[model samples]
Target: MYTTVELVRGSSKLADEKAMSAADVEMYIKKAQARIDARLKKRYRVPLAEPVPDIIESIATDFAAGFAIEKYYSQRPGKEEPYLAEVLIKRAEADLAEVLEEHLLDGLPGVEFLPPPGPAPAVLARPAMQSTTPVRSEMTAALERW
Candidate 1:
């Protein structure tokens, strides 16, 4: 898995590097991991209560670093181009989505389909004489009674 150092190096422009410290980047990593984890849990039927997969952690950290750099530049005094930060953040988001899609298509590690939730109903022979009655929802039946 990619460490925080890798993320900082990958995303931050030289100009934006001064604004972000290692500690700040670490915080960003945590936020990014949580966001990524939440997305994984929502999208795939995987067991995320366990440790995050290496691939996921690496991608998330990389995206987090880019986002931190973007945030820093966007808030800088006398900003020249706010779009730069926006571009960086958007790219990071897209990259994450692409990676996630590929990984899902490959298959998640532990998510498998279980058998039908409840027990199967038992089949029984029917009586020869059957009542001819229409079945309706409880609400419809009650309304007819009224």
Candidate 2:
């Protein structure tokens, strides 16, 4: 039962971390887009220019790298920093998603909306623990008695 609780906690932390990473990526993309817009208006003197997709992708990659680091640090026993960061990430991602949707759909009509940030890919590979006795042995014995 304790192990189950720990697993649940770990899963929750993982979810939070992924969400935070997504938000950070979104923020970096937004700021980069703003800068690009400013530059185009002041220097290039263009009335309107779309932000480059490559810039957003680069920022997303950097955010993922940061998440990887957090995951690494979280492996230390009794450390909660990583878990806290994970929760913060979820809030950030939700906020960023709303902002992105508003900006992207400002002028477009009849366009389907983009999906918000989804689950993050598993970064750490956990080796399955091997035990001689089956975990469900008691349950199996009970069913046999029935």
Worst 10 residues of 2 by lDDT: 1-10
| lDDT per residue (tens digit) for residues 41-64 in model 1 | 645544343455555655665567
Best by TM-score: 1
lDDT of each: 0.58, 0.41
* Model 2 residue 129 distance off true place after TM-score fit, in angstroms: 59
TM-score of each: 0.50, 0.27
* Highest-scoring model, lDDT: 1
Model 2: per-residue Cα lDDT over 4-119, one tens digit each:
22222333343454444545434433443454334333222222323423323333333333344355565677557566545544443554354355453344333233355567
